[model samples]
Target chain A: MFLETVLLAQRELRRNVLRSSLTVLGIVIGVAAVITLVTIGNGATQQVAEQIGSLGSNMLQLRPGQGFRGPGGASSDSKRFTLEDAQAISNDIPGLAAVAPTANASTQAIYGNENWSTSITGSTNDFLKVRNWDLDSGREFGDGELQSGRAVCIIGATVKKELFGGQEPIGQSIRLKKIAFQVVGVLKSKGQASFGNDQDDFVLIPIRTLHRRIAGNADVGGIMVSVRDADAIDEAKSAIERLMRERRRIAYGGQDDFNVGDMREIMSTVTGTTKILTALLAAVAAVSLVVGGIGIMNIMLVSVTERTREIGIRLAIGALGREVMMQFLVEAVVLSGFGGIVGIALGLGAAAAGSVVLKVPFVLEPGIVVLAFGFSSVVGIVFGFFPARKAARLDPIEALRHE
Target chain B: MNETPVSSNNNGAAANGAAANGALIRLQAVTKVYGTGIAAVEALKGIDLRIGQGEFVAIMGPSGSGKSTCMNILGCLDVPTAGTYFFQGRNVGRLTQDQRALLRREHLGFVFQGFNLLGRTSALENAELPLIYRGLPVKKRRVLAREALASVGLSGWETHTPAELSGGQQQRVAIARAIVTHPKVLLADEPTGNLDSERSREVMELLTALNRDRGITILMVTHEPDMAKYAARQVHFMDGLIDGRSTEGGA
Candidate 1:
């Protein structure tokens, strides 16, 4: 019976080759579009996760605020933490590995008739250890230079490539705001971080040097801390906050005038948000599959109406209603199965092209492929049933009377 | 007929002077009425019939006679509105639709006026359709179909579709399809209606050969007296009732 149904369906498909092919094309494009969009979304998410993991997983950032807030907000105006507060945290906290006072300002650097606009960060020698940035050449400023506020600087690789252009920049002297600073070191490349800013695109100078020669402000921007391990980060956070509250002479139960951020916590929150957005996008694309199923239903119904006499002949020749139903149902499933295979191929191709264009890794999961195929088959069965039932229930005598 | 299988079970009854004829089909007080109330039509009125085994019968009638209604009831394509029909040993009015279909497929063969071979199907495929419905294996069905077509002198034309065949050959293929299952009764309603006189005689000759030589029962409906003359017995119908009957080939 199954073999006979297959043969009959094949004949029916051959009889209306153009229409059947068009129906299959509709389902293929729908399935392929869904898969491609989902694949690209997943690839973008994976790229973000990788960037977060590559940044020092053990680092925490402390900015002066009530809690975490974006750049534009009403509470943006607040007293910045000073270098003394950073030193007090470094000295008092037991689980802390290193702490650095950091500040940044966009400035014009002059180097032998080659002056360029660049960003410069001022911090202590521990900044390299806290941020997990490596030194490409030379050495950090000595304690004598930092204490006396000598204008020695460490240039980032981007700044090095821009100002010196393939030339060794360790001993080169560059002037910032009319003060000459010798480049004592260069930092290694750290690519772009999750915030879309290049970590290796700024120069570093001594904190005291930045205070006296550059910004001439005693209030530092923030403090960056590195923990011994991930497990001790939360304990280290509370310890530093307690010490800062006591040193700043705040009354008991007063809110601390700073925010402590764990890199892992921020990453998890960002990943969660992006995942929700990706699912929402995928759901929107899924609507196309339902519409494609409806198209199949419409076409199949038309086929039933057209082939009334054929159905009558089969019913008269001892074929049961179940057999008639099976024939049309099998036809629908075959069309959808063919579409599913083509869609998978198209989706994989689109994903590969997207990865190349976006400069991200192509990530294809086998489960998603299985899911798409399963969905196509289900759509076929669900939509094919109405027409099949219509065919099965037709009366043989009346159908034979149809012109 | 020399091909008739001998059954001696009723030998004592025959010796007791009982007639040897056995009813292969029986219809009692059958009537068919279509539609409701004022627009109603009585297509068959109180029809009673008994056709014995190995009888070649012809029904002659005009268009509005009850002959077509009797043909429909005999073919099990429809049931009488109020009657008891005993086909073989079973009561047909009590059977389910699928059961009726099975009986038709197994015990009855139909040849329609239009030479109703499925369009686009090859001659051999058309012959094999009934056997396919019977669930015969593919190789056996092919062999049986080839033999049936060869018997009807369409051996080499197995691959030709209906459109490619002459009218006589297409009706011959229809006959092949009808007889492939070796049904107990062949019911042909104006089997040659669409053919020329020569082709019509050729189709009539094949039906007569199957009836006379092979000892298979045949019930045919036709308008031409010459076509009715080929049957051993004839019944004419008028005004939704059987009006006359006659037996031919007597001394």
Candidate 2:
């Protein structure tokens, strides 16, 4: 019986190959869209998470004068954090990994005959440790460089690639703001961070060099603090808050005039936003599957009306009503199964193409492929049921009489 | 499933004397009325029939004389409004649709006026259809279908579809399909109605041979007296009633 039905389906399918192919095509596009969108979204989110994780997970940034106002009820300047505050935090905070007070200024760096414009960041050696950065060559600024406020500099991979022409850039002097600074080291490439900024585009110098020689300002931008353990972030945050409030002489019940930005909190926010966006995009793609299912329903209805006489003949020949129903149901399932196969191929192709275009890794999840195929079949069964039942319920005598 | 028990040829239950003559079919006062109230048309008005085993019977009537309706009841294609139809000692009127289908597929084979062969099907496949419904293996069905087609003088024409065959040959294929299941009775309604005279005679000869030589009971409906001559018995119906009955001279 199964063989006869298979032969019947094959014969019928062969009779109208063009029509069957067209039906399968509808399902292909739907599955392909779902796979491509999901893969690209997944790849992007993975990239962001990796970048965020590579950064200092236990690090927190302390900005002075919260909400653009001072504790004295006066409008505060954005650059309210000072070198003195940085020193106070370093001295007061226990279980501290490292503290770096950073101030940045965009300036031009020049060698003997080469010149390049880049952002010059002034900070102590602790800046590299707190930011989870490592040097590829030479050494960091030592006590000698810091005591004399020597104009020594560390360049990033991009600056290395540009000025050094792929050569080893260690121990090479580059002038910043027309001041000559010895090249201490080249930092390893960190790629692009979650904030879309190139982590390797800046040159680092000592804080004294920037405040005394370049910017001539004692004010600091922000103090980055690396805690000893990531699990102690909450305790460290409250301690830092209390210390800063005391240092600034804030009354009890008064909000601290500063913001503590934890990397963990930022990571949660970033991932949460990405998950919502992925859902939104995936939901939009699912609508197309519904459209594809409706297409199956429409075609199956047409097939039923066209094959009324054939149905009558089978019924007269002792085929039970359920048998007739199963044949059509199986045909619908076969159609969707064919569509699923083609859709999987299309989806893989789309994902491959997307990886090249988006410049991100291509991830083909086995679970998603299985899900799309299963969903397509369910769509076929759910939508194909009505037409099959309608055909089964048809009276054989009436059907035989239909022209 | 051939569940209807075949009555023993030696049984002497003659309490219902009409059933004693070894009639394979007994229709007692069968009536089929279409619609209800004043708009109703009585297709068969209390039809009583008894056809014996191995008998080639023809029911002759003009159009609208309840002949086709009687055929429908005999074919088990429709149920009677109110009557008792004993097919091989079992009450067919009380049987379910599946039972009727099983009885038709196992005990009775049909040939229609239009030679209702599936258009795209080969002669062999058409012949094998009944066995397919019977759940026979493919190889066995193929072998049986080939034998049935060969019996109808259609050897080596198994692969030819109906459209490719001549009218006589198409009817032969239909006949092959009917006899493939080795049914107890063959029911044909104007089996040669759509054929030329030469083809019609050929179809009639095949039916006559099956009835006489194979001992298969045959019931045929026709209006032509010439067609009725091939049967062993004739039943003339008129105005929704049997007008007369006669036996054909031995061939």
Candidate 2 segments exceeding 4 Å error? A1-11, A56-85, A92-96, A103-122, A135-139, A142-153, A159-186, A192-195, A205-221, A227-264, B1-22, B36-39, B223-225, B237-239, B245-251
Q: Residue B197 lDDT in model 2?
A: 89
Clashing pairs in 2: A66-A257, A66-A258
Cα miss at A329, model 2 (Å)? Answer: 0.9
Error of 1 at A73 (Å): 9.8
Residue by residue across A219-317, what tens digits does model 2's lDDT show?
677788999988898899888888888877789998777877777676676777776887688778878887888888888889999889777766665
lDDT of 1 by residue, A109-152 (tens): 88886878888889988889987778988999899999989999
Model 1 CA deviation exceeding 4 Å by range = A1-4, A66-79, A107-120, A137-186, A190-196, A208-216, A234-259, B1-22, B64-69, B115-119, B212-216, B223-226, B245-251
Q: How does residue B235 of candidate 1 score in lDDT?
A: 78
Give per-residue CA lDDT, model 1, range B1-251, as digits (tens): 11222243243224423122356666777899989799999998987676777788898899999898898888887888987676775678889887988988888888877777778889999888888788898899999999999989998999999999999999999889889999888988888788889998999999999987777789999998888888888878888888756443111
Q: Best TM-score goes to which candidate?
A: 1
Task: Estimate, for each residue in B110-143, the C-alpha lDDT of model 2 and write its tens digit.
Answer: 7877777877789999888778778899999999
Report backbone clashes per prediction.
0, 2
Clashing pairs in 1: none
